[model samples]
Target: MTQRTIKVGMLMAKESPDLISLVGYQTSASAVLIGLDRINAENLLPNINFTFTWYFDECQPYKTAGYLTKLILIDKVDVVFGPTCPEWKARKISGGIVL
Candidate 1:
C-alpha cells in the first residue's frame, strides 16, 4: 500500500453563538475526528492520511449547493458527506439534471 492523502469534504450546521442558543444538538464533526483517530491508531488505512475540508450549510439548499460546488471544484475532494437534504441527494444521483 502506498502513502496517500485522501481529502474528504464535510457539510454541517456550524452553530453560531445565537444559533447554538436556539437549537443545540451537537454537530457530528467531532465524531468524524474520533473515527479518523481510530483509523490511524489501528493502522486501518494502509499509509493513508485522511484530511477533511468543512463547510457550513446552515440547513439551506442554496448554500448547500454552493458548498457542494466549491468542494467538488476547488477542493477536489475524493468524498463529500453532507447536505443531507433530499433535493441535494437527488441532484447528485440525477446527474444535476432538472425535471
Candidate 2:
C-alpha cells in the first residue's frame, strides 16, 4: 500500500503564568495529542499518516489571522483545528468579508 502524510495545523492558546490556567492549557493540548496518537496507533486511515504543528495564538484575532495565513501559505497544512475563542470567531468575518 502506498503511504501519504497529511500535515495538520493546530492552534492552541498560549500558556498562562497562573498554575490553574496552565494546567487547563496543558490538558486541552494533551487531549488533542492523545487523540492523534490513538488514531496513528490504530492505523485508522489505512496507509495515511498524520503530522501536526502547533501554533500558539493566545486567542487573539490578529495573531489568529496571521497564524492561519502562515499555516495555509507557508506551512501548507492540509487541515487546521483551533483558536477556540469567541474573538477568533468574530474575526472570521468583518465588514461582510470573510477573513
Candidate 3:
C-alpha cells in the first residue's frame, strides 16, 4: 500500500532579509522540519509521509493573518505549525481548519 503525503503549513517571521538562518535550531521553521525528519526517519507514523509548505510572517500581525488564511484556505494543509508568536495567530479557525 502507498502512504499518503501530509502537508504541514509553517509560518515564520523573517526578521532580516539578510539573515539566512531563523532562530538557529532553537525554534523556527527549520526546527519544525528537523522534528518532522526525525519522525519520518523513525517510521513513527507508519504509512504517513509528512511534507511542508512555508510562509513568512515577517513579524507583523496583519501579515501573519494573511499567511494563515492562505495556508488554511488555499493550501488546504492537513496541519499547521509555526507563526510562533501568539500575537500573530489568526482569528479564523473555522471550516475544519487546524491552527
* Highest-lDDT candidate: 1
lDDT of 1 by residue, 1-99 (tens): 778999998776655554433322254666777888898788887888888888776666777777888887789888878664546553474336222
Candidate 3: where are CA atoms >4 Å away?
16-27, 92-99
TM-score of each: 0.74, 0.71, 0.68
Best by TM-score: 1
lDDT tens string, model 2, 1-99?
888999997776656444326434577678877987888788777888778877777766777777777777788888877654546443464213323
Off by over 4 Å in 2: 17-25, 88-99
Pairs in clash, predicted candidate 1: none
RMSD in order of candidates: 4.5, 3.9, 4.2
* Residue 28 miss distance in model 3 (angstroms): 2.6
Error of 1 at 55 (Å): 0.6
Candidate 3 or 1, higher lDDT: 1
lDDT of each: 0.69, 0.68, 0.67
What does the lDDT read for residue 4 in candidate 1? 92
